[model samples]
Target: AQILQLLRDLVSERDTALILITHDLGVVAGMCERVNVMYAGMFMETGSADALFARPRHPYTLGLLQSVPRLDAGRRQELQPIPGAPRNMLSPPTECPFAPRCRFEVEESRQAVPPLEELESGHHVRCFNPVPAEEWQRTRVGAA
Candidate 1:
């Protein structure tokens, strides 16, 4: 493990950028400085991996985080799953894309797409009525 860490450190000492595509958020948390979160060919958020994980602004990013089990979390704590299935690429959407199954979607969301806006600094969300962080917490507790 020490040898492997040394090799990783040596690689990071270079100017080369390594793009790792994986569902392993733990790996990203440990080794990555930046993160690009994407869904349905659209970017949900992009920024420092640590900052994003610490206080996720996008509902999608929150969902992704919720789905990952944490060693620090209690054993009785059940990880939340990402809601809804992926849209069929064969039959693309015409609205906010995620409106169909999004809990925070409004009528307008189903009729029009919303641009990704910078909520704060590097955090951005492509939602007109994103679920509030408080509401998300309630929903998780209720579901559990």
Candidate 2:
């Protein structure tokens, strides 16, 4: 925590740009203005942190957020983990890398790579089918 504070101070004092690469959403929320969600070593979603967190357009990004433990959640609340393990990078499939585990998988996503599409101003996602914010939240709650 001290180190993170120091880094934050340095950036502010020096008027410098900082690129933080981390899997911890808490850190991202605390320090980042923008965010890039990566899977299989490739970015699946890129957007402002607020936009991405409020309504993730990529299934992988949604899965990641849903899997985190929320402080406001009930004590007995169960974590909604992503259904399957990550794909092997050594033998990557030509199609959408997340298809094997994504619930919104479509035929095009399985047959060909999905290009990043801008769904909103400054929000982009590489997915053929994306779950709306409400549906994703519903699914996450239902799964738990």
* lDDT on C-alpha atoms for all candidate structures: 0.72, 0.86
Q: Candidate 1, residues 21-106: lDDT per residue as tens digits?
A: 87887677766778888877887677788667766656677778778776666889887787788788676568876666566678
Please give the TM-score that candidate 2 achieves against the real structure: 0.90
* Over 4 Å off, model 2: 136-144
TM-scores for every predicted model: 0.77, 0.90
Q: Give the best candidate by TM-score.
A: 2
Worst 10 residues of 1 by lDDT: 135-144
Error of 2 at 138 (Å): 4.3
| RMSD of candidates 1 onward, in order | 3.9, 2.7
